[model samples]
Target: MSHPQGKELSIAVVGGGISALAAAHRLVELAPRCRLKVFEATGRLGGVISTVHRDGYQIEQSADNFITTVPHAVKLCQQLGLEHQLVETNPQYRRTFVVRQGRLHKLPDGFLMMAPTRLWPLAVTPILSPLGKLRAALEYFVPPRRDDADESMAAFVRRRLGGEVFQRLVEPLVSAVYAADMEKLSVLATLPRFREMECRYGSLIRAMRAQRRLHPQTTHESGARYSMFVTLRDGLTSLVDALAARLPPGSVCLNTEVVGLQRA
Candidate 1:
């Protein structure tokens, strides 16, 4: 908390979102003596991540779950002493469905986002047309883009698999999870491994097949790895509350908008 000149450090965090709160918490943990202030533009905290309880039901305003494959969120929860409140997804409902022509069809087995580990399932899936299925299968022969330049998720899927696969399968599945426009979402920022798979194995299908061979247990899995997701039993807002509780009193300034910054 002290500079080299022996002056006390003063830190200001702008925003009341989960990311800002987490950063503020980490700062307090690492520098207990520092003067820290959090400025929030809104009167409420947690931003879009809010959990509302009504009539014995918990409704999430935005993201309801966090993936455990990445350890950061789980680790943070542990640090906040909320590990006991963590609840896993129900085994009976750990599946995703896509609406095609007013009917809900289960995603193809081993189809995780854009890559399909099994060809037979993708071949027979009702989500894609016969031509779309054939086009997706042909992804194994499509040449990989060797450049390192960034591209949209739409462009990447359409180029590697086909327009039909992007519009029908990949578009819906990814959009449901991220709630983003595929045309604007960056492939590198979201699912970089698929791009790496293409660069390494020359084709996404080939890479997925090789992966399935190595991890035979995932052969029946589809869409995202739902088993890895979890949430607080009380709701995600508990995390924000826990974080706010750790900050010193009078440190949070809500409804304070910071328009610009000038170096001292």
Candidate 2:
């Protein structure tokens, strides 16, 4: 929609979640002279993003950090002038642990999500059996499917890696992220990059290797790559607070429920 200059244009933004707040902020940026109103159903904002400080400890109730691979979150922080407050994950404790047979085992180094970039770590890791490791290693030789149709993540992983790798490693790791049945989860809907890897380089391992070569700086160290995950030192809620602070006074309505909208 185009708003002529000096014309009083009124815009109503429903909800108070991060998306809504960002939208409101964008509207203000685009049309400073326009009147904007924000309606929130609850007393507080941020939706699932909540941070609380209690008993001399600061805790994040949800969404502690965001990955930087997708730079939208980082760009938003920069736009809010919170880049100085951004902090990276500790380099020392970056490895993820998975439970197997009532034991906690560290995820193999260079093992990103579903693919393994380093063979030595996979060879020594006890999480996978000799046969499973062999099958996973064979992923480099596997042929890629030419079909453009969508496929389930379970099917893709099993076809490329193997049943053992899927059940033990891929399944549990993916489950932790999506909390959905892999058989029903569309790889295109969730992680299309893995699918793209198959189509582009014929294997996930090959794609990862090429990516590392392209950006070696990101993988210079082992364990959790601290640069990938970023958050504000104060908390994620600080973002919400910053956006809310930018809106004009009396423009926000708390405990206001919007049932529907109609174009008049």
Candidate 3:
């Protein structure tokens, strides 16, 4: 594309991952005639999100599906004309199991990440003991902290809920998702909404209820919408292939790692 000075525009994208590829695609879409150069340290694209075909089975190395609730990945796929290739997660067996005491236990229904929106499911779930459940339910009455300060996930959960609830429910679930030490993981960085909810409504359950009243989807959709998690029927490689095909010929430079940038 021509710059304001009537000169051809140029951009250098340094990576072969989906994020970098998406950036390059957007740049090209916005500036059709721009000289785009994609520098990749690796020979192949998609970075850690690699898929393998072995004996008619597709194996995903890192992440398999993208959630459509956010609309970015799905929009990109649609833009690339890969809509026909989109496939949703199987309706059956959509629940995740947590291992408690070396036994696999299904996560409580109506449980949205750290807290539960529905009382019946939370009441019936055996994930927590009677005392722990009572403490969790008491979250509705717990007053929120007045000061606005950043806190760790462990501290926030323990403060909002109770120690038993944090240990029995929140810690394990957070560990499974982030795999990071709870003490080190910042609640502000990871789950700022929960903090905001506490600040606004004084309790997670209260906040969730208010949110549900404001937006009916929050209650209707509740955690783990399997249909929202979509993937290419041919596997994630198809997305990379489609994106790569859209680039100008020889625009991608393999094995060229950009460690840093300097202003000219």
Best by TM-score: 1
| Residue-level lDDT for 95 in candidate 2 | 64
RMSD score of candidate 3 (Å): 3.4
What ranking of all candidate models by TM-score puts the best one first?
A: 1, 2, 3
Task: Write model 3 residue lDDT over 76-117, tens digit each, in one string.
Answer: 999999999999887565666666888887777656667766
TM-score of 1: 0.91
Q: Which sequence of candidate numbers ranks them by lDDT, best first?
A: 1, 2, 3
Off by over 4 Å in 1: 262-264
Candidate 3: deviation at residue 238, Å?
2.0
Candidate 2 displacement at residue 69 in angstroms: 3.7
As for TM-score, the candidate ahead, 2 or 3, is 2
Clashes of each: 0, 0, 2
Note the residue pairs that clash in candidate 1.
none
Q: Which ten residues in a row have the lowest lDDT in candidate 2?
A: 217-226
Worst 10 residues of 1 by lDDT: 1-10
**Poorest lDDT segment (10 consecutive residues) of candidate 3:** 216-225
Model 2 alpha-carbon miss at residue 114, Å: 1.6
* Predicted structure 2: lDDT: 0.84
Candidates in order have lDDT scores of 0.90, 0.84, 0.81
